[model samples]
Target: MGYEWLALAAAFLWAISSLISVTPARHLGPFSYSRWRMGCTAVMLTIMALIVGGWGSVSTAHVMPMVLSGLIGIFIGDTALFACMNRMGPRQAGLLFSCHAVFSAILGYWLFNETWHLAEIIGATLVFSGVVTAIFFGRKGSDNNDWEALHGKLAIGVALGLLAALCQALGGIIAKPVMQTDINPIAASAIRMITAFAAHSLFWASGAKLAKSKNPINRKIFSITALNGFLAMAVGMTLILYALQDGNVGMVALLSSTTPIMVLPLLWFITKQRPNHYAWFGAILAVIGTGLIVS
Candidate 1:
């Protein structure tokens, strides 16, 4: 399959993972879930690295950039995402997180001088506008102040999601320079994961007592976090890197940005919470935009 197709598949898997993660986030705090996700990803990637080449391909020059990318993308970006998910719910958080495409596109353009065609730009704009409309204006039978307060909270969540997106985009751009080196993608990813693990360890070490007191860990939370780590970080990110191997970074990011669209139907199926019509429209626009950009 083409990289675009692989990216789409990854997006679907990520969406499912996100939906599933929300369940655990409700019980275990976002930081707890993030710690589990990062830790598991580090372990899995380390095993893969050992089996593949034992870091023989990795160079000292590439190490720092990979570490920075991992810190920003996995440690910071993912933590912010989980926080937004907890505060804003899955739908709104997913929609806002979709802005990763825009941020990636901008960073790719600046970093690599990638340019977009008119059709691609128009398609992206349409998709983004549709998503914003759906998130802000598509509520049904809600005129209460509480509803307004929800919208306000969603706005803040969206802002944080955008910040995460920016970090992810910059991380990808920074990774590109490293990818151009002789380092293997798998090894590079492992290095990144190692750094992420270290950063997260520090975070947890400093906040362990507070986290334990605030949100006690339970069986269900651990199970969900483990599942999220496998699906979202390990499988999804591996597939993304594979896709990037065959395509432009911007196209890969755009295609992968459809994760929110994929999540909508899965949410409906799992939670029986169908997206509003506007959301459905936005999802369609996102798919179409991805096609235009990638093709």
Candidate 2:
């Protein structure tokens, strides 16, 4: 029971990462930022894995699945999420990303032959309704803070956010079977981060237009980006996997999906303005919906 709290802690760290990432993600652009973040995280995980002898648990058979997971989850999912955050701000992006719980549940039902009762269906509905409500009515006209302002088209942000959520769902599905084995979660995470970093590096070397950074990385931005990587991927993700080792999957997902709600006060503290009623209501609705599904 106490171990389940790891999921909540992970959610809190992720909320903080969202705040820390805004500047770097905005400055470097999503693709470049993700590349740098993955590289930093890969190094950190690799060192940690070595220190703990976590690599002993890994096998050649686990490589491909981990690669796929990293490609879909870290490479695409993470980039899309930050891109969405760059446009819609962390509050909206976080809410949309929380839909990963719904996506994960649906995918689990389909792929694992897991049966869902009526509660899950209602939960899914509430999650969707919450997302819609928050996106449409989350902000007041008086909220003119840059963090609350939309950077680009709302439609693009919404699409990117949903894409990130779907990719996250797919990533988890791909990794679940492999994770049931005795492989070390730290080593597993290291492999995924390395795979993602390679993918990002390759993309950058190919000179893709979108891969270009909006501004050159400076010490300040690099430090913040590295810290974001450490918090979000190295620690935050590892915590979720650790919790999943002992906690119920549904319960873990339900707890972790509360990142949006957890970010509200952090947003208020930083921005010096409370989120509107719609924001609070929508976040609560989504969490409640997740509770019903996982309960």
Candidate 3:
């Protein structure tokens, strides 16, 4: 299949992984989950890189960018995302995380001197409007709820989601420059995973001591976390690398941002939490916007 198609597959897998992650995330703290997830991804990708002979071409010149990409995208991005999921629930968090495309587009333009067409701008605006509208209007609780209570964790979640988007955007831009060098994408991804694993380990070690006595890391959570990590690395990173190989960063980012659309249906089917009219409208708009931008 074409690189764009690969990217689309990657996005779909990521969406499925995200939906799967929510169940385990509910049981485990975001930090703990993120720690294990990154660790597993690091191991899995390392083995893949070695098996495919992708690691033989790695060099020092590619090290920093790859490491930084991992630190920003995997460590910070996933950690913030999990935190958002814990605070805002999956739907709201997913909507907010969709802003990653916009951030990535802007960053790609600034960093790579990529040009944006009017159609792209219009499409992105539509997607952003749809996602924000869904988030604001489709809240679960009643209006009488105090702003302090309703806003606290959810607001934090949104902010963190925005931060994660920015980090991912920056990391994507960083990865682009390095991809032009001698380093192969798979090896670069492996390097990134290593740094991410280290950072996550530090976080986990520091936090584990203070975790509540009843903290649970059962078989189900472990399995899901492992699956999430493996798919994210093996599929998500591979597709992203391929997309960057033949596509503009803005287009690739926008296309991949459709993941939430892929995910929402799974969430609805599994949980029976049907989205309201506004959410459905937003999802449609998002899909249209992504198509226009990518086209």
Q: Quick one: how many clashes does candidate 3 have?
A: 0
Collision pairs in model 1: none
Choose 1 or 2, whichever is better by lDDT: 2
What are the models' TM-scores? 0.87, 0.89, 0.86
Q: For model 2, how does the per-residue alpha-carbon lDDT over 22-105 read when each residue is reduced to its tens digit?
A: 999999999999999999999999999999999999999988998999999889999999999999888778778888877877
Ranking by lDDT: 2, 3, 1
State the C-alpha lDDT per candidate.
0.72, 0.83, 0.73
Off by over 4 Å in 3: 1-3, 133-152, 207-214, 293-295
> Which lDDT value does model 2 have at 138?
67
RMSD of 1: 3.2
Off by over 4 Å in 1: 133-156, 207-213
